[model samples]
Target: MRSDGTLSLERRRQEREEAKLLVLRKRGSRLAFEWGLQQCVKSVNATPRLLVYLLREVCVLAGRLARGGRV
Candidate 1:
């Protein structure tokens, strides 16, 4: 959350990523989210593939925008 009572997109991403990674850390035997792990075999309780892809893409798109690159 920001002073204006809303989260910046980047901030929101970080928070969400933290939540996602925490689940992995506590349950998937992972310390952090990894791109390579996205498509790996895992228990059904692990994070969904679509979430991993979307979160990664969101961050990539955000980086591109930050660098003034076209989407």
Candidate 2:
């Protein structure tokens, strides 16, 4: 018996291939989700460092502008 109720070796092979594809798809999605979560955690932990660097750069630029009398 096949998906369409017809017995054939081709159909069985197709079904096997489809099943393998589905499993691979599920595994890929799981890995992608976990990788995204890890990236999120890394970015979250670096948030404060990013903010501090941004502010420091901003202050430096502001000082340079003031020195040029372009406040």
Candidate 3:
């Protein structure tokens, strides 16, 4: 009986910790998204096409790095 009670208590503690971590993760992602959006909006002559091109270039470079090639 005592062990069962301890296990329940530990389970509750773990659940509370998980909830806190999820909230923190959400807040961090929201902040990052807002920051990136602000930068994109503030850029001069920024367009969807340009953004797509930049993303493609980044992916290409990342692939090269993953293949052990100089980016």
Candidate 4:
């Protein structure tokens, strides 16, 4: 970093990804959320329908836990 307060593109991308992870954790995100997102993304044949369904279920579970309800 120079006195100009500018960051390289690679450094900026790493910071952005770190910030995103922080936000997810602050919002009660869990391992299941990460796993579902990663698994679907890694699948070559992943479809919008399946992704939506998986995300929906993850959201519901997270919400339930956040509200102090049993999983």
TM-score of every prediction relative to native = 0.39, 0.32, 0.39, 0.39
Candidate 1 residue-wise lDDT, 25-69, digit = tens: 566332344532553344233335436754676687688899999
In the range 1-71, model 2's lDDT, one tens digit per residue, is 76887878755654554454446446764443344344346655433333443455457658878899542
Cα misplacement distance, residue 18 of candidate 4 (Å): 34
- What lDDT score is found at residue 25 in candidate 1? 54
| Candidate 2 deviant stretches above 4 angstroms | 1-46, 69-71
lDDT for 12 (candidate 2): 65
Model 4 bad stretches (over 4 Å): 1-42
Evaluate model 4: give its TM-score: 0.39
lDDT of 3 at 33: 38
Note the clash tally of each candidate: 0, 0, 0, 0
Model 2 residue 50 distance off true place after TM-score fit, in angstroms: 0.2
Q: After superposition, how far is residue 54 of candidate 1 from its true place, in Å?
A: 20
| Candidate 1: segments with Cα more than 4 A from true spot | 1-3, 31-71
Instruction: Encode model 3's per-residue lDDT on 21-60: one tens digit a residue.
Output: 4464467644433443454577654445435545655677
